[model samples]
Target: MTKNNAQKKAARLHQAANRGTPFPSAMRAVDTRLPAAVPGTPWFRERKRRLVCYCCGHPNLIASFGDEREDTARFELYCENSGCDAREIAVIALSGNMIGTSSRADVRTLTHFPQSATSHRTVNGRYDDWLAGSEPWVRTQRGEDFPCLWCGEMDSRLSQNDVATDRSRFHLRCLNTSCVVREYAVLIVRDGTLGTADRPDVMAIQYIDTPPSSRRTPGDASYDFVAMQRVLDEDDKLARRRSTGPIDWSAATRIR
Candidate 1:
């Protein structure tokens, strides 16, 4: 097929899949390219907003199409959750060159988009420096403002800022309200002198991941009685087996 025909076919396939239709061929693949950077301003620091899964709250969503071009960008994304088939389309307009800035963004998502899916967690290039041990790292005092990895907002605050007992290590958290995901980074000072234990010249930085949140959708309140009945039946069988005081290991065989 021609390039234009392939693009049209991909769009048709996407629409059919959204409508719960089976694909004509399992070998067919969508003619889409992965975006090199997050959709937003041209600056890397401005790419702060991420498309999250609305149904499962997954951080990574696969982009179907839409390249960030001109002052406006459109993103077509699908959930990474195997059990959930949530798809979303978002359009972002850059007002003053950055997203999730101090003035916020003029971005807009689909009406069905849940608030939980709008995450401000974005890591642009800071992590690369952490790995390369780049020089002139951020130096800060306790409770002061620092560059945030997630929101990229200028008004980000640093807390839990204190030097460790080792005198060479320090730690702090990005308490920026604009960012949904909390950021905690470990730092080490080359001078090994944490004067007054307040200010530290960070030489090396390490990013720490936050705890995983619940994947269950907030809107799903109703339980599947049929699935629940199956679970109860399984529990009863397990209870009967436990009544023997221990599981019979000799009879246990791996199922292929």
Candidate 2:
């Protein structure tokens, strides 16, 4: 090809390469304040609002937090397009006690909070049992399928699921990971209180050493239990820092 043609082809290839690259993921900012509507009162209304999808930017869906209670609100937003199962969903449970709202009008104020960008680690399926049964802080029941509090992924139907106390919850798998063998803790914050044992809320991460005898992958043969332990241990430390307000080194380190 001629020099001019070669240059044009190179330019086209560069443009195509850039187009193929995926965009970075982002999280929405969470507001921890309750709305003005009382749970039992007639004035209390669960409103669903629509916004342009951050991924496709198509103004085709409505999303909002389910409702506001005494000092907490469970908010969920997802794509409305039936054809688009992009899984671009966010579920946020905010605490309102720390930040006071003057009235219901104030509660309407919304912000785009960012989620943690860190890539998730993998764990074993055996640990999944411990998470669902033993961990009280990270469990949520949905019909027969139990979803994890941290990532909201469901547990295996074959495995028996368990429940925890009102304060904490957990799930067997990390939806963000590929192996489907990771566990996550779901910590609920009450009234925006931080660091205090009474008000402290957190989600812990843990992994198992050996793969289940039922199934194993080529990658599983090389799994390192020690590394997994360190990761969980570090995650626990980071969870403590995140629950506290200071935003210390531990919190800053584990987060991507």
Candidate 3:
């Protein structure tokens, strides 16, 4: 979608999340004090080119952070797609001696936000278990059937078909009429010398047909490597720029 469309969708999603009139329980639990990204911040730049929504595959997302603690900080990322309920919370563990002394570059750890008693939406089991259950399947050989990641009941119904990457390929689709993710998810396999002589290292990249984030020239991979590389470059530059300065928590919420 265009930038204008993305902005409109973000407004709609925000309204939907904050609706407290008819369905109070439906309203999302968002912290008002969360720090929004400033114009030149790394988070702001990440929102522009990367961070695709897991549900609707939209690029319009909101990135925010909570107050930094002694050795950790929390980040909240949510899609702005009005129809999507995709959001993720990640905790970054800081390295070094002093509190808030380390920059983003100094942080090398990522973990899930601790679950609260009131929130049933957080992962139900161990973080590793949740990842194993939710992540898309990666295949190197044949005979393995790809399942529908979105359809809980009809998970194993979708059969493996071809959608080619380097050498091998596979396609998966949920036949369930009521399933939200009815689109075909293609797993592009990378073959040849990437792996051992017997098996090749296949990278399964999900390609949905409907969303703006999935729009690409025909035959292109799900990711735009060049664009992603540029984003990484920008992140490195931003990290370097912020390395010497102390984080101004009070100034974080201000948007220019």
Candidate 4:
């Protein structure tokens, strides 16, 4: 987008930002990439405001957005809870170049992007640095911000033996004794946002699983009838010879 057109988009979005302006110091937050930096004006930080559906608080996929070009972004937030399928549109303008700073180094760098995702959290990189950067890590070297999904325990601590290589992995363990949490990796929940003990807007880890005794649909011929018959036959054989103990109905619990 041209600098002039970018400026117009910023202006319109600026109005929305002004309405919900956060009470922080104003700072320009985009790389204009212009030939020369503008001087003598104080930089106005880009304002961020999210529009989610009132019916449902969370949206399904942010993977879709409109005009996601450089300067301004217009996007639709979709919520799919209980087949509601509600949507809320959102707009935000990015400011390029600090108003008064002649050099880029003089202004605070603002990174505008979401965190990357991975199929497995066990991969190695500076992600350890990011995951370990939570408030709990600084205060007590724990992973309270991104708790272990298995144990639901947040006493996360880094491995003591990591050599600190770029691709070297950062391992975390849950402190719970009865739980099965161990050395595992982390997942980025939010990029460019620091999570604290009070607010955990950072990385996390979760495990997905299914029980082996999951129920199948009734009258479904796709099931293994031979295996079911074999089990029934085995039970018949056991019933013929079993006299070791009497039935104890009180010890058994009903599924329903």
Candidate 5:
């Protein structure tokens, strides 16, 4: 499908998730946070391009803390620009793809009244379980036989089948969210770097599956030799550029 078509379908899926919900709370529980990338992931060792911040144009904004969930590592990227209080969370599979909203560009506001606790919307879950239960809601792959993923029960409301990604390819969902998997973030990674808006180096990359890749041709096997060499040549380049130091941009006044 064309980019425009994909976007429209994604919006519908989001709507369906909310409209046909048997469990709104569960949906919230599932789709909230962004996971991080770590050593165990497939791409971590491969050395793709550095993950730059799409929001404020900051490069390598990720901070990784060894959380308990080995399968699902959590990565938090906060834009500490004086007035730009945008932040994002991401979840990375052991295999190395950024699943769900971690792949999204539009950000959630880091909650704090000029200076307070930034309300994080990120939710964490066991990686394997999440991966196994929630298969990609692809029409070509799994959409033919399965009913609507959102409701799990086909109501008259979910008569049509149109899927889309958001304005950016950050997330994809049913034109209407039924109840479950339709409204979800598409796994967006390209050339080893996590893809985001306006970043051509990684944009338009094929969606790489977190688990075993099904496509025989060009699975998650591609990498940028130039970028990889940079990783080896300047081992501390990324580390020095993206320090996980405590971020306290609270003092930076917000401009209306």
Candidate 6:
């Protein structure tokens, strides 16, 4: 098909997919290029305000905005790998009066766009050195090594060995051949008189890709810390329940 026809077909396929229709073949036929970066788009402005590289704290480009109100605002971010050509695209929304700040870190977490599926491979360039002195954390326990959270690979190494602040944690890259996913988690420690102890009570999972539409933006709604707390509390309960067994029920609920 002609390029213009393919673009139109892709747009239609996306609309169909959003409406719960199955159009995989049609979607695959059309090229899914990164939406043109516009200087004055709302999503671009929002990214300029809130989007930052989790590793280097560098700002990302506003890749695209939704043609409709409910569709997510898509963005592209560069990775910290100086030798890797991988970029991270995230989707975000406003929660309260704030446009980019959200109380629940994981509520609007990443939804990765496959690297192989994109038109361009990310260029390895050192624009920032956020994880300059960080250590790599790998999965080497007994039994089966947990899949690297970021790239879905079996060889994801931690970007930081020691986390100083609550937000200064590290991420793991996925090892799956075609998936360029990045996963982030935090290690919390309980404060006591003598010394603080590590607490597995809280764990946050951040995506290396775009966040879901429901979570990208902030609105005028009051910051519902209590509601957010409830979500976290339930998450903790679920984790505890799962830790008692070998089967991980959490992975089952991931959005496909």
Off by over 4 Å in 1: 1-140, 165-169, 187-256
Model 3 segments more than 4 A misplaced? 1-147, 156-167, 189-192, 195-230, 233-256
Segments in model 5 whose C-alpha atoms lie over 4 Å from true places: 1-39, 42-50, 64-69, 80-83, 92-169, 172-256
lDDT of 5 by residue, 194-222 (tens): 22222321121111111112222333355
Candidates in descending TM-score order: 6, 1, 3, 2, 5, 4
Q: Any idea what lDDT model 1 has? A: 0.30
What lDDT does model 5 reach?
Answer: 0.27
Q: List residue ranges in candidate 2 displaced over 4 A.
A: 1-46, 63-72, 91-256
Poorest stretch of ten by lDDT in candidate 5: 203-212
| lDDT (C-alpha, whole model) for all candidates | 0.30, 0.27, 0.29, 0.27, 0.27, 0.30
Each model's Cα RMSD: 20.7, 22.7, 22.0, 26.8, 23.4, 20.1
Q: How many residue pairs clash in each candidate?
A: 0, 22, 0, 1, 35, 33
Candidate 1 vs 4: which has more TM-score: 1
Error of 6 at 148 (Å): 31
lDDT of 6 by residue, 95-166 (tens): 222222333333233221111111112222365232222221222222233333222235533334223322
Query: lDDT per residue, candidate 2, 1-256, as tens digits?
Result: 5754544455455546666321110000111232444323111123334544322335543443322222222223445554332222322322222222212211211111112211222221442211111222122233344433223344321112223232222223333343222332222221112211221122111011111222233445543344554443223221221232332223212211
Q: What is the lDDT of residue 118 in candidate 1?
A: 14
lDDT of 3 by residue, 112-193 (tens): 1111111112222332212211222233323433333333343323233433331221234446565443333221111111
On TM-score, the candidate that comes out on top is 6
TM-score of each: 0.22, 0.21, 0.22, 0.19, 0.21, 0.24
lDDT per residue for candidate 1 within 162-230, as digits (tens), equals 322322222334455544334332222111122212221111000000001211223445432345444
Error of 1 at 235 (Å): 42
